[model samples]
Target: MRRLPLLLLPLALAACNGGTGTPVTIDVKSDDGDNGSFRMENGTVSIKGDGFQGNFRVPQIKMKADDVDLDGVKLYPKSEIAGFHITGGDKPGNGKDGGKDGSKGGGKDDGKVRIDFTSPASLAAVQNWFRDGFTKKGFTFASRGDGFAGTTSDGGTFTLDLSADGGQKVKGRMEMTGS
Candidate 1:
């Protein structure tokens, strides 16, 4: 696995009205695979998967999204197991000055964040949700043969594979590979 270089990726999220915005429940199921379920409520998020289970309360988050704030919303996973959170760690660097954090080695270094999830929202609504959300933060997107591809203002790239689950649920896979 490679580490994505840190760049000025252009992606965005919008801020809701109140300080305590509407909390979202993410169903961890996808069109191609099913991871499990993630219920984010009150201040804690509970995870249930095929071979793993864990629960942790989120810190008090008064996060308000800015047009250019990539970390406006944050997810802090408390599970000891690896791969629970998105965006694995970067590989340690070899430097004379020891610029890299050596303690971060031996962890997942895949330069990708893959999330599969479903919601009761319609496919169109879900599509528009991402489309509008990212474009506002300055990501240029185009429809691809596989799905929708987008590049951030700083050239970071991501792909979205989405499908309707035949019910009202919209299923999607979000793979983010960025520098």
Candidate 2:
């Protein structure tokens, strides 16, 4: 029976490829039966399935934290916004395609943004910084098994997740929705 699952694995994975021909690689390691990880690297996108966390890195897309408005929330000191996507307002560029809409435009806050970033700081520090910033802004923040989530008084929501990068840095992604 165990071998049946192993045989079916390829089929399951093939469905994930989406026929992009971009080449997808997945690595899964489990300590027990339930506690394990699933990681996939496909071109510029990397995902960790255990926690539903991932980030996309594209060379053509250029951005900074200042370029997008996250209300009054602040990012960790020296953190870099590696990729972003904004819609619903006059925001610049798409996080998935780098302004593929052919508009070098700017707009008002539509209260929706997805940001992927890297921080030289440790994972714990990054979480603390966001928790502090959001709470002060009146957002209720709580820790999940993998990361943190919060919501604003007016219906805004924020999510954060960071994983160690096998070195001194951490890579993470954050998303906010609602104005």
Candidate 3:
């Protein structure tokens, strides 16, 4: 009986260490069906674990876009982020970084549309919106800093910024050219 407990100890430890964690992947695409690609190079994200924590380093990422080439885009830790949250569809506040605010109304003035989601499903939905939204609006965009910038086919420049909080929440920014 004493030996039985000892033998079970290692088995229990192995079970806890099983490598079955799911990895998160983000894909970016353009709306116009134009041929272009976006890539993320040299990035790191810190994830909080229960009692224990971990970090991941992404050396590179390859994103396929319809019209613009984003092969050189990259993301790195600007500062330590904690307690991240993800929201979707016309949120009021800006992302965790307090970068830019999102707008509610949908129109030519809406310019940029922001969507927030955590799982792949939500991200896919948002990407689809990006495709349709820009296409319907007739706009061309390019990656700018930690966000994007471009001119609408109607001759309006817009800026959009998206931030993810440790796979918890995503916030968006939709700012028109002037004001």
Candidate 4:
């Protein structure tokens, strides 16, 4: 009887630390439609060990309209694992034309945007959110395959896609380039 308990103790311990339930991490590279001529670089997202938390970092981004350059934009997972809270500001620079006599004037800009959920269950929610948010601001979603390609109120066209590999994880890709 003593030996049986000893054997079961190790088995129970092994079950507790099976190491098979370890959280999986994914890296996503995304683009925020700003200017097609100018390439936005240093976009990366990392999910934490628990999967419920995450971080998004964009080291650099260039856009023509606001003449915006983003350095190290960070996002954190929010109420919903699929949602994120972004916090950061823009870098200094004009678009293709540097702030010059004929070039677009440049200035400082700062704000935060809430990235809503975009998973299988939240697909409709995502679409509605985008439609309401962008359309109210003067944008529309043009037809695309499992996504939408459209123009912003500011005259910037972009494509957004939501993807799921039939698993727990869902991914979204947004690409915006000058029209």
Strongest candidate by lDDT: 2
- Candidate 4 matches the true fold with a TM-score of 0.34
Candidate 1 per-residue lDDT over residues 112-158, each given as its tens digit: 55554454556676667666666677777887643578776766677
Determine the C-alpha RMSD for candidate 4 after optimal superposition of all C-alphas. Answer: 18.6
The models' CA-based lDDT, in order, is 0.45, 0.54, 0.34, 0.36
Candidate 2: how many backbone clashes?
3
Candidate 4 per-residue C-alpha lDDT over 62-167 given as tens digits, one digit per residue, 9 for 90 to 100? 2221111112111112212233233323233433443334546364333232233334444555455455555566676675766567776655556667655355
Cα lDDT of model 2 by residue, 1-179, tens digit = 11322433343344342322222233333222222222223335444444354455432223444544456776676767665544333233523333446655343244456677777877777777777777777877788755688777676787777787756578877888764
Better of 2 and 4 by lDDT: 2
TM-score of each: 0.43, 0.49, 0.28, 0.34
Candidate 1, residue 113: Cα displacement in angstroms equals 1.0
Question: Which of the two candidates, 2 or 4, achieves a greater TM-score against the reference?
Answer: 2
lDDT of 3 by residue, 29-90 (tens): 22222111111123433433123233444432221122121122211212111111221121
Better of 2 and 3 by TM-score: 2
Record all residue pairs in model 4 with backbone atoms less than 3 Å apart, i.e. clashing.
Answer: 33-176, 35-178, 36-177, 36-178, 69-91
Q: Give candidate 4's error at residue 104 in angstroms.
A: 11
Candidate 1 TM-score, C-alpha based: 0.43
Query: Model 4, poorest ten-residue lDDT window?
Result: 31-40
